[model samples]
Target: TQLLEQSPQFLSIQEGENLTVYCNSSSVFSSLQWYRQEPGEGPVLLVTVVTGGEVKKLKRLTFQFGDARKDSSLHITAAQPGDTGLYLCAGSESYGNKLVFGAGTILRVKS
Candidate 1:
């Protein structure tokens, strides 16, 4: 079983600033996913990186998978207040397998 650990349990930043959150594990994973959850709502998928050293961009958000596939990071450029929420990272050992989730990072962006 792979155990994912996320850094910075909580983060508070001002709007328009930039920040990065990380996910790491000792065991390798086939794929890694990032999600965002708001109050009273389920986590919303942001991106998934399957290839090592791969990077995906969604608008102002950037997701990158480590060269070893054992780590990942989410970077937000010019963060906004609307981006405040819980960010979670999950790893899948293989296709069709259950994902192991990290403890999550709480992000609070103030305007």
Candidate 2:
């Protein structure tokens, strides 16, 4: 099983809408990062939250870190067709340099 698991593996929302995807892990990390990938391209880092209970907002998106540092969530507001892509969460494991990733959440924003 992946060290991190994301809920609602897939999401389809209409444009101008809003949605949220969650990433959960039993293990704790010093920090966690979120990414978005479009077709035929590498994932671009969205944001990294290191402090527990920290929240960051970018444009119409919002991200929150769990108080325990074991989970995180991404919320998109007024979704746009161009926002359709794959969202992923990654973090370093406690034991080694291995970076564990969530299963990945696929988001489709329909126009």
Candidate 3:
């Protein structure tokens, strides 16, 4: 399989809904980073999980890293038009400055 994979490349939902995006990998990673990117803008770091089975919450977003460090997920509690953007998950071998991004999940939250 591709080093990292994301499903449903696209997502659309009404406001006030919930959604989840996933990232999967076959190889283990030392650290995984999640970023949200908007059109014509660089991705902004949302969170990073170093240890396995780590969960971090930010506002309406919840991020989790798998026990093996090979996978991760992002869950949004309540959707909004402002939540529309591309969600990318990247994995690094040893906490290096490099990252391999997933296919990306394009979220479109309708009003």
Candidate 4:
């Protein structure tokens, strides 16, 4: 089975701080998807990196896919209060159409 696990189940920091969240797995995946979800809302797609070693950036956020397609990372720069939310990493299995999500990393950025 392909499973993804994220580090630091919870993170709390003051505004303007920087942090990195990691997603690792023992099995390979065809693609990796990054999402951020706010309270009571569905997760919003942040980025989707398909190639190994691929990197994508959105605003103050950076995402990277592992060379073996078994891991990924998210880096946030100058975090703001609005950045506080649940961060999830999902990986698509070899045959399934559904994505298996990680335990999630809950982040809190206080002003």
Q: Indicate the worst ten consecutive residues by lDDT in candidate 4.
A: 91-100
lDDT tens digits, residues 1-111, model 2? Answer: 348999889999899988999999888887889999999999999999989999999999999999999999999999999999999999876566667788899999989
The digit string of per-residue lDDT tens for model 1 on 1-111 reads: 789999889999999999999999999999999999999999999998999999999999999999999999999999999999999999997667799999999999999
* lDDT of all predictions: 0.96, 0.90, 0.91, 0.96
Query: How many clashing residue pairs appear in each of the predictions shown?
Result: 0, 0, 0, 0
lDDT of 1 at 85: 99
> Could you give the C-alpha RMSD of every candidate to the true structure, in order shown?
0.8, 1.6, 1.6, 0.8
TM-score of 2: 0.93
Which candidate number maximizes lDDT? 1
Ranking by lDDT: 1, 4, 3, 2
- Which window of ten consecutive residues has the lowest lDDT sum in model 2? 92-101
- Residue ranges of candidate 3 with Cα displaced over 4 Å: none
- Which pairs of residues collide in candidate 1? none
- Per-candidate TM-scores read 0.97, 0.93, 0.94, 0.97
Model 2 clash tally? 0
13-70 in candidate 4: lDDT tens per residue?
9999999999999999999999999999999999999999999999999999999999
lDDT of 3 at 4: 86
Candidate 3 overall lDDT versus native: 0.91
TM-score of 4: 0.97
